[model samples]
Target: MEPTPRPLSPHLGIYRWQVQMVTSILHRLTGIALVFGSLMVLAGLFALAMGETSYTAFQHFSASPLGLILLVGWTWSLVFHACNGLRHLLQAAGVGFATVVFIRNSWLVIFVSLVLTILIWAWVIFGGAL
Candidate 1:
């Protein structure tokens, strides 16, 4: 006798994407990205200790197009991660647990993070502190 075909189990495709889901995924990803950013930090510090030649090379790389892109991405990740983390902390303290409040807070995290990131980069671009 032929075996009967079984129905496939639903996976990610079954669920509609939502703000909470997006923020959750981004939180984890940005956390990982920050770890790499830290390595870049360490490299900068090491270059400083290696004296002017190495430090100047590091500065040039940081000013390059690719480096600027990475820097901007890293800055966004840092802000997003911090915002999401603060939301998580609030939830742990029994705040924003209601469905409406939860969804609203998720959007808030996204909005605030993006706004803050833009402000930060703008300051840097405009030559911070006149």
Candidate 2:
């Protein structure tokens, strides 16, 4: 006797996307990006310790377009991870449990993170005095 075919289990396509879900995924992704960013930071420090020549090379790379793009992405990742981490801490304390509140806070985290990233870049570009 032949076996009958079974219906596939629910997957990504089966569910409507939600803010909380997106935030959770982004939190994990940003955590990973931060790890790579930290490695880059370590490399820069190591170059500095080596001497002026090595440090200058690191600085040159950091000033390149690709380096600037990575820096921007790292900045956003840091901001998003920090905001979402605070949200997680609040949830752990039993705050924002209501569905509406949770969704609202998720969007709040995203908005605040973007605003912070933009503000930082603006300051770097336009603010003259340190």
Candidate 3:
């Protein structure tokens, strides 16, 4: 018997970029960022537990420009991860399965996460209802 030829797979170039793609990729990358950010938090806690001097040293380092950038990135990562995770939970429940609804939710996840991150930072800097 003659062998049948298999159909060729579609090339990556065939697909145009979409917001859904960005949201999916960002979801994964932000998950990784959250892991590192958690480690930083743990280290901060460890420093605090060690003694006042150690905690003060950690404070100084955290106040540095590089630390501030990392802190902001970590904050954004957390917000984005949580928003995307909730979106995924809704999707698992068969919500937002329509094409238009999925795309809109993707964009909403990004926007809402950023707004939340900004709000959190503002509260942190300005003091949150304290």
- The prediction achieving the highest lDDT against the true structure is 2
Flag the better candidate by TM-score, 2 or 3: 2
The count of backbone overlaps in candidate 2 is 0
lDDT for each candidate structure: 0.94, 0.95, 0.91
**TM-scores, in order shown?**
0.88, 0.87, 0.85
Expressed as tens digits, the lDDT of each residue in 15-120 for candidate 3 is 6899998898899899999899988989899999999999998899888999889999988999999999999999999999999999999999999999999998
Candidate 3 at 118: error in angstroms?
A: 1.1
* Pick by lDDT: 1 or 3, better one: 1
Candidate 3 weakest ten by summed lDDT: 6-15
- Clashing pairs for model 2 are none
- Per-prediction tally of clashes: 0, 0, 0
Tell me the tens digit of each residue's lDDT in model 1 across 23-116: 8889999999999999999999999999999999999999999899999999999999999999999999999989899999999999999999
